[model samples]
Target: MRSCSGWRRFLLCFSLLLIIFHIFSVFEFHPNSVIEIAPKKRNKKSDHLVLGPAAGQGLPNRLQCQGSKALNKSHFLTPSNASNVGDSISFVTVFTIYSTSLDSHADDKSSNLVTVGNVSYTKKERSMAILNVFINFIEVTMPQSNVIILADPESDLSLQRNKVTLYPIQGEYNRDKLMLQRIRSYIAFLNTRLKELAQNPGHTSHYIFTDSDIAVVDDLEHIFQKFPNFHLALTFRNNREQPLNSGFIAVRGTPESILRAKIFLQDVLEVYTLKYTNASRMLGDHLALAWVIKSQPNFDLRRFSKAQAFIEEIDGASVLFLPCATYNWTPPEGAGQFRGMPLDVKVVHFKGSRKRLMLESWNFFSSASDISDMLCLILMSGRTRYDF
Candidate 1:
C-alpha cells in the first residue's frame, strides 16, 4: 500500500510540471524577438478625443513605426492612449504655382549657375527649383500620397510623378499682378477646390494648403495625426487668438469645414476686388481666415501655437490653440525662430531674401542642409548680408 501511494504521487507531480511548462510556453519570451501587440477595437463615439493632440508638446514629425528596435515602445502614443493613433490618417496637400519669378519684382536676370538633380536652372528657374526641391522632398518623405499643383494658365508647371496631380487654374488672373493679387488668386483656386471637396467628402478626409516656397523637411504623417477631430487647423503668426498663417492650414473632409474655407476665400477675394479693404493686411491670408473663423459658427477651429498644433496643451478638449516651433520655421521675424537640432525643424519657409539665398546656396550644396544647418545658414547669411 505504501509503494502504490508513492507511485501515484510521482505521476501527479510529473503531470503538474508538464501543465506549467505549456502555460509558460504560450508567453515565451525570446531575447531577439519583438512582439507587436495588435491594437484592440475602439468605440466609435470616442471620436471626440481625436480633436487635439494628447498633451501637446514638442514631438518629432517622423514617428517610428511599430516593431522598431531603437525606440522605446512606451514613447509612442498607442490607440489605447490616443483615439486616432492607430487610425490610418489620410491628407492631400494643395500647392499653387503662379509664375516662376523668385522675387516679387520681375527681372531680366538670366538663370544662375545653380543646378539641382543635375539640371541647370536660371534665377527664374531657381525660383521654380526651390519649388522642385520642396515637392521632391515632400514626395520622398511622404510616399503613397497625393499632391495637387494648381498652375496658372500661362504658367507651365510640369510634375511627372506618380502621386502628383496637376490642374491648371482657369482664372485669367494676370501673373504680373502684385504679390497680394497673386495670393488672392491662389486662395481663390484653393477655395473653389475645397468647395468641391466639401460637396463630396468621400475622396479624402483632410487637405493641406501651402505656399510653393515652403519645404517640408520632416515626415508629416505624425503632424496630420495630431489634429484628427478638428474640422480646420491653422498655425498662428505669434500667439493664439492672433492672425493665422494660411500658408500651412489643414482642414477635415467635412462640408462645414469646406464651407468655412469658401467663406474665407470669398472674403479675401472681396477685400482685393470689391470690398476695398486694406490690401496689404487682407492679402496676408491670415487675417482673412481669422475673420472667417470668428464670423462663422463653431466649426472645430484649432490653431498651432508654435508648430505641433496644440500638441503640448494639457487640455485635450480645447478645439482651438497654438502649435510648437517645429511645425514651421521661417527667416522673417514674428515667424517662429529655430534654435534646436536640424532634425527637429519640420518645415522651412524661404521668406523674402531667404528664398534668394537658398536658391543661391543650392548651387553649392546639392540640397538644403538638414533643417538645422539650412536654418543656421539662412540666418547667418541674412545677418551678414542684409543686416537683419
Candidate 2:
C-alpha cells in the first residue's frame, strides 16, 4: 500500500512538471514570435482628423473575417496580414524656410536684385508671388485643405493671412559656417514641434518639409488619407550622379520619423564639423538635407522611389506638387526670353540669375488676357459656369 501511494505521488509530480514546461515553450521569447504576439493596439487617443477606418479594427467582410478568425486561433497578428487592420488616417503639415544671403551679386548680373530695386522689394515681390501661387494652387489643387507653414519670425506679416498657419523661428544673421549650424539648429526646433504634436495627440498625423521657394502646383488631397505606413516621400533627380533635392519631403509623424530625423541631424552636424571645420565652405540648406537623407535608411532611392511628377502620389490617396513659379523658377538671363513651356513642370526651381525678370514675366502671364482670360472665358461660355 505504501509503495503504491509513493508511485502515485511520483506520477503526479512528473505530470505537473510537464505542464509547466509546455506553458514555457508556448510563451518562449522567439524573435520571430515577438512580432506575432498580441496585436499592437492602436493609440485611440491619437488625433483622428479624417475618419476612414479605425485602427486595429478589421473590416467586416468575408476575407477579413476569415483572417481575423485565423489571427484569433493563432493568438497573434501576422505582420503580413496586419497592414489592412492598422491605422490609415493621417494629417498634413508644411514647413517652409527662407534664409538670408550676404553676397547678393555673387551669382550673376541679371539675378533678381538688379531688377527688383532693393532686397526688400525683391523679398516682398517674391513673397507675393508665392502667396498668389499658393492661393491658386489650393483653389485648383486642394480646395479644401488645411496646412501649417513654418517660417522665420522676420518673415513678412502679410504672408500670414488666410488659411496658412505660420510658425516662426528666431532669425540669425551669421552667414558663414554658422549658416550650416543654423540649419542643424532648425532640426532641434522641428523636433520640438513634432514632440509637442506628439504630446498633444490632436496634432497632425503627417508632416511635409518644403522649402519656401517651392510651391504646390497640383492637387494633393490623396496624401493625407494614407498614413503611418508610407514612412518617407521625396523627389530625386533623374541624373544618378546628382543626389536627391530635398526641396519637398513628406513623412508620417510616427515615432520612427521623429527619432530618425534627430539622429540624422546629429550625424550631419558631425560630418560638417569634420569636413568644413569653418564657415568658409558655404554649404546651403539643400546640401545639409541631402547629407541627412543620404545617410538615412528610409530616404534612400530604394525605399522612397521618385515619382515622375513633382507631384507625389502617396499610396494612391494623396498628391503633392510644387506650388507656383514664384516659389520655384529660374529667371531668364540677359536677352533670354522666358519661354513658358509646360513640361511636367509642377514646381519651377529658379536656379538662374533672372529672378526679378522672371517675376515680371510671371506677373505678365498671370494677368494676361490669354491664359487666365481664356480660362475665364471658357468657364463663362460653358453651359456649366464655374465660380473662381
Best by TM-score: 1
Segments of candidate 1 deviating more than 4 angstroms: 1-120, 175-205, 239-242, 271-283, 290-324, 332-344, 357-388
Tens digit per residue, CA lDDT, model 1, 1-388: 9999999999999999999997677657553332333122221112111111111114454222221111211222222333332323333433334464445235445433444335555555555666666665565445444576665556655557666667665554443343355455556655776667656656554566676667665565565455555545556555445456656756554655555555545565554454334444334345555565555454344443334445221112223333424555554422233343223556666655455555543443345333333333444433211200
TM-score of 1: 0.55
- Which is the leading candidate under lDDT? 1
Candidate 2 RMSD computed on C-alpha atoms after optimal superposition onto the true structure: 26.5
Return the lDDT, model 2, position 259: 56
Cα RMSD, each candidate: 24.1, 26.5
Which ten residues in a row are the worst by lDDT in model 2? 379-388
Candidate 2's displacement at residue 213, Å, is 2.3
* True-vs-predicted CA distance for residue 288, candidate 1, Å: 3.2
Clash tally for model 1: 18
